[model samples]
Target: MAKVGGVVAAGFLGLSGLIWFVNLPYPMIRRPVAGIAPMLLLPSYLSMDRNYREAIAHVEQADQLVNQATSAADIGLGAEKVKLAQENLDQLPVWFLGYEPVRMCHFMGCSWNFTFDEFSRARAQVGRMNARIFQENNALTQLQTAETDLQKAKQAYQTATNVSQQQNAIADWQTALDQLTVLPRETLAGTTGATKYRNYERDFNRVVGSVAGSNQTQTMIAAAQQFAALATQNSQKSAYTVTEWQQIETLWSNAIDRLQKVDSTDPDYLAAQSYLADYTQKLGVVKTRLETEEKSTLAIAEAKRQTQELISSLPSKPNPDERNRLISRLQGIIDQLKQVQPNTTVYAEAQTLLKQAQSKLSQL
Candidate 1:
């Protein structure tokens, strides 16, 4: 009977120790057990290491999804992954083992070497992923709203019979475009919005320009004034590309056309005439700038072509005639570079080439 009681007591203690070992990674079990037998807390450290690695894997997966997400569905999936990662990280006892306890555990041949810093960094990565997902979802919503607004504006513009209605529709259209413009470009929705914006702007300009020969003189004058203002604003800016200058030129032309639509019998005919004169002058100026930009671009291209040819054909040992020919051609290239006007898109490039050409000319 004594031997049986001793065996039974030993069996109970063994089972209790096994239960305690299994649950030591958890705070509730580790708090009491660690106070009495801190050496046995190795299981808790091992569990923490495992959780940290799992959280890291989840974070990486979430990051990949968020970066490549093209739709709301993708963002939703990424959010789930990040949330799981956060939950896993939350299981770590960062406060409990952050100092002396972790250092002591390191001496016990336990391989759980994760630091508080590593844990914090992993949490921060998860946080950033969550933020990106939130931003992407918000961008998607904005895109949908912008698209709806665009459709409404188009419908209003197409059905309007009077100038006031058309003007209001135009305002709505601009607001829609503004929404698209402000979307975060790193997001999928923003990229889609950009493409839509380009198409919308082109179509809107074409539709606005199509209004002509209407008896609504006030409408014609108002449209003309708006185009004139846009043209002036664009024209006053420097460093416009050739294509940009051409668009500005088109604006001026559109303004002039609108003013010409005003009938002589209309009440606003005199005002339209005044606007026509001013717009025509601005159109002429825009045309001049366009011409300069084209000529300068052509000059730079021709200079580069000549320089390349000269480089390919130059003799290793040149006589006076060959040397003189090279110098003449280089001088011509320098002249071409000098023709590129300031405030043109290619002006900086041209200036850089000009210095090289001048230096080469002197060397020749």
Candidate 2:
């Protein structure tokens, strides 16, 4: 009976040892075994300690890389380091072990305690790094897009043949510059964008000046000025005939039309606008003059016709009622003649007719 009990005990001890040996690599599985034979888990504890140390090292290196990063490539490398650190932290079996393996093996002169705090901190760092990477990458994309637009705008401006094309190119160039101005200054791409913006702004102004100095813009301005001068010279005359006033009105109108055609993109556009306003006012004046001349000429003719009709209709020696009617008609003709304004072609004729009507009224 004693010998059978000894054999069974030997078999049980051998099976337990085999289980401990096979489960040494897995902390969760070997944790219970450690309670029965703590000495058997020394190798597993040392391995866990190494992983923890490696994870901490990775975290430090990642932090350093990220802090010093100046470009997207540097940030990418930092991201890889962060990933490696996370992988190392994941391998650490902190769930089953309450203390670091280094702490468990205190005789090895290591005193670190295992806690999820460091793991959590690492994870937080990863989140921050990822956010930074996203920001930098997005800024890089913006920088690239802005640069491409700037190049295209330059090309367009250099090759443009017309004012419209040059204006469009300048507009595009301004849009590109606007894009660069909005980038975050902390990013590598943003810094580069800023440097480019200063140079591009100067170029943009130069291009605008070039477009303004183009032959088409200058020619248009000259033509507008010529028309304005002609209109000014012609409008200086007073008391113009209806036909003459109409021609003066046309001259002012032509000047205004030419000024209106000057493109806003031209540097001379503001001057053109000033000329346009002046010309438009002159046009209104000339048009008023033309209208007055036509009206005055018709009024004088009408007054003369009425005077002749009154003379013909007079009853040789008019009765008191007929004389009063004739006098009233003459007074009305005089009043109408008085309304013919100065500066009209009919003013002189209207004055002569007014005197005749007044004399006829007095005679009646």
Q: Which candidate has the top score in TM-score?
A: 2
Worst 10 residues of 1 by lDDT: 209-218
252-356 in candidate 1: lDDT tens per residue?
887888688566866677878888988888788778888889988998999899899999998999999999998988898888899999878889999999998
Per-residue error for 84 in candidate 1, Å, reads 1.2
The backbone clash count of each candidate, in order, is: 0, 0
Local lDDT at 185 for model 2 = 88
Predictions in order: lDDT: 0.79, 0.75
Q: Across residues 58-156, which tens digit of lDDT does each residue of candidate 2 receive?
A: 778777777677767787888888888778767666665463443345677542355578667767887787787778779989999999998998899
Q: When superposed on Cα atoms, how far off is each prediction in RMSD?
A: 12.9, 30.2
